[model samples]
Target: MEPEKLRKRINELAAKKKKEGLSETEEVERAALRAEFLANFRQAFRSQVEMMQVFDKAGKEVTPEKVREIQRKKGLRDD
Candidate 1:
């Protein structure tokens, strides 16, 4: 399912759970949806972190070596 729909369904399931509780099947579906959401969230956050550049007041790069290596591998930086 698409991200938006997945989120919507998850919220629906949560509301149902809060008001009346879920069936076993609905509980399983909610668990799967939660896992998918977390995986997507982690990947997006990692991508943003990988693309970042940190600098100091002196105008020199201060990005960590590990982050720079990841950016280099992704072709976002050259040095």
Candidate 2:
């Protein structure tokens, strides 16, 4: 294709996108939702960190492998 044709096509698409109105209110709503999501994520992250600290200080490692071993030793597996 010609360079001028490509430029015209690009400009047309840009204009169309601009006309579609990706709104400021929508952006503000998205930011508010994201802030709430991040706050919840941080809370959960801190809780997990605290849980790990307690597990470490209490001298117990809550690993899947350890749970599996305990289950095996106790004959707790149905299969």
Task: Name the candidate that leads on TM-score.
Answer: 1
Which ten contiguous residues of candidate 1 have the minimum total lDDT? 70-79
For model 1 the TM-score comes to 0.95
C-alpha lDDT of candidate 1 relative to the true structure: 0.95
| Model number with the top lDDT | 1
What is the lDDT for 41 in model 1?
92
Worst 10 residues of 2 by lDDT: 46-55
Residue lDDT tens for model 1, 1-79: 7899999999999999999999999999999999999999999999899999999999999999999999899888879
Task: State the lDDT at 61 in candidate 2.
Answer: 52
Per-residue lDDT for 1-79 in model 2, tens only? 3445544554554565578854576556545555565676697875564433224567785546645555566675433
- Each model's Cα RMSD: 0.8, 14.6
Residue 48 CA displacement from its true place in model 2, Å: 0.4
lDDT, residue 71, model 2: 56
